[model samples]
Target: MSGEERGKRAARNEDLFRQVNERLHDLAVISGSSEPHGKFVCECEQTSCSLLVELSAGEYGAVRANDTRFLVFPEPWHTSPEVEAVVERHDRYWVVEKRGTAGAEAEDLAERGSNLL
Candidate 1:
């Protein structure tokens, strides 16, 4: 795949992971506890990556403020230059933004809750 294709794929994968976390958040809210922090799957480009990252509800909300920003483990193995840019690094995770066409697509999916490609 070309760099552009890889970037789009990465964005789609991360969005899917984010949806799963959002569902969990909704469930927590319904249950009344609504835990402030929880472990969520790393919203990275690598589909095989099963690593989980911890985030507070506020931190997650901050990431959701921009559809391109994703939470990824701050490890060397998680790097993907063609797909995303590491915008911020925290103790447990790094904030990555999808680039190029991928970013546009991610923003679209975030708004529509559906896939375009």
Candidate 2:
């Protein structure tokens, strides 16, 4: 696949994972859970990845402040260097910012709330 196509695909995968995490967060809030941190799945490009990262609501909110950014496991393998860059490194997870085509696609997905079904 072309680079742009690959970037788009990666963006879609990451967005889907983000949606799942969002739903889990919402559910936790509705259930009145007082847990300080939640286990969110790694929002990476790889569909086969099932790794989970723990983050508090505030930390996840920081990542969500930018549409192009995502929370991923703090390992090199969870990041796609071609379409994203590691912006922040934490103990259990890393923040990645999508660039180029991937950035545009991620922003679009966030704005439209599309491709979640």
Error of 2 at 63 (Å): 0.7
Candidate 2 per-residue C-alpha lDDT over 91-116 given as tens digits, one digit per residue, 9 for 90 to 100: 98999999999999999999998756
Candidate 2, residue 114: Cα displacement in angstroms equals: 1.0
Q: In candidate 1, which residue ranges exceed 4 Å CA deviation? A: 34-36, 115-117
List clash counts for every candidate, in order: 0, 0
**What is the Cα-based lDDT of residue 19 in candidate 1?**
90
Measured against the true structure, the TM-scores of the candidates, in listed sequence, are: 0.87, 0.96
lDDT of 1 by residue, 1-117 (tens): 887777777778888988987876666667776455777788877789989888887888899899888888888578687767899999988988887888987997898887433
Please identify model 2 stretches exceeding 4 Å from their true place.
none
- Poorest lDDT segment (10 consecutive residues) of candidate 1: 27-36
RMSD of 2: 0.9
TM-score of 1: 0.87
Report the number of backbone clashes for model 2: 0
* Deviation from native of the Cα of residue 64 in model 2, angstroms: 1.1
Q: Which candidate tops lDDT?
A: 2
